[model samples]
Target: MNKQQLQQQIEQVYLDILIELNLEKVDTYFAPDYVQVTDHITTDINEFKAHLEKLKAVVKSLTIETFKDMLIDEEKQTVFLRYDVIVEKKDNSIGNIEVYAVFTFNDDGKVIACNELTKEYDEQVKGLGSI
Candidate 1:
């Protein structure tokens, strides 16, 4: 796909999946064999879905505080993204995290793999990225 298409897809995923926690749209953006490595911990599609479910249960809202960068390599079907997230829990607690991620899209435009690193903007809120 071209750069604009890739950018739109990624942006939509962030909105529908990460911010909205719409689990039904997971398959639309991710391949069946999707795999992810977050903060050196690896997880497959099932694990990723579970993580989203957990977030959906505890998170009241999630916002992308900043989109620092998005670099796409269309020929290689890869994109790099750097962003900050602000997550508010149901109990009114907030956590901020900064993330840098690289995603690889399959021929069908589904994400096949992702490698990412996240740093807590404040004290160590464990598993803020993958949780």
Candidate 2:
């Protein structure tokens, strides 16, 4: 697949992260040996799924607003995406912010890794003494 196709596959998985609790969808999108490297965390495919499961239990839905930035390196199979996310919770609360995201897909069009740099609204509130 080309760079666009690879980004599409990665974006789909991110979109599905909130809508579906089915791990198999992730399994289908991500290579079995996928390795994720985040700003503060690094994990394999299974470990990342575990983190998603925990998130799914608390986050009711995720709304993403993505901007198609430059394809940083087509040859390297990577894309730079900028997005805003609304992380919905059960208590009628929302976590909203924009962040930078990167996704890399394997040769066969499965996402090999995904990473995001996001800011937490609650954490910001805490800094302002509103936690």
Clashing pairs in 2: none
Clash count, candidate 2: 0
**47-87 per-residue lDDT for model 1 (tens digits):** 99999999899889989966899999999999999998887
Model 1 error, position 126 (Å): 2.9
- Model 2 Cα lDDT, one tens digit per residue, 18-121: 45656668877788888876555678877877777776666676676656464556788887777666667666677675657677777877777767666556
Per-candidate alpha-carbon RMSD to the true structure: 1.1, 4.4
Q: Estimated TM-score per prediction?
A: 0.95, 0.78
At residue 1, candidate 1 shows an lDDT of 85
Estimate every model's Cα lDDT from 0 to 1: 0.91, 0.65
Query: Any runs in candidate 1 off by more than 4 Å, and if so which?
Result: none
Highest lDDT: give the candidate number: 1
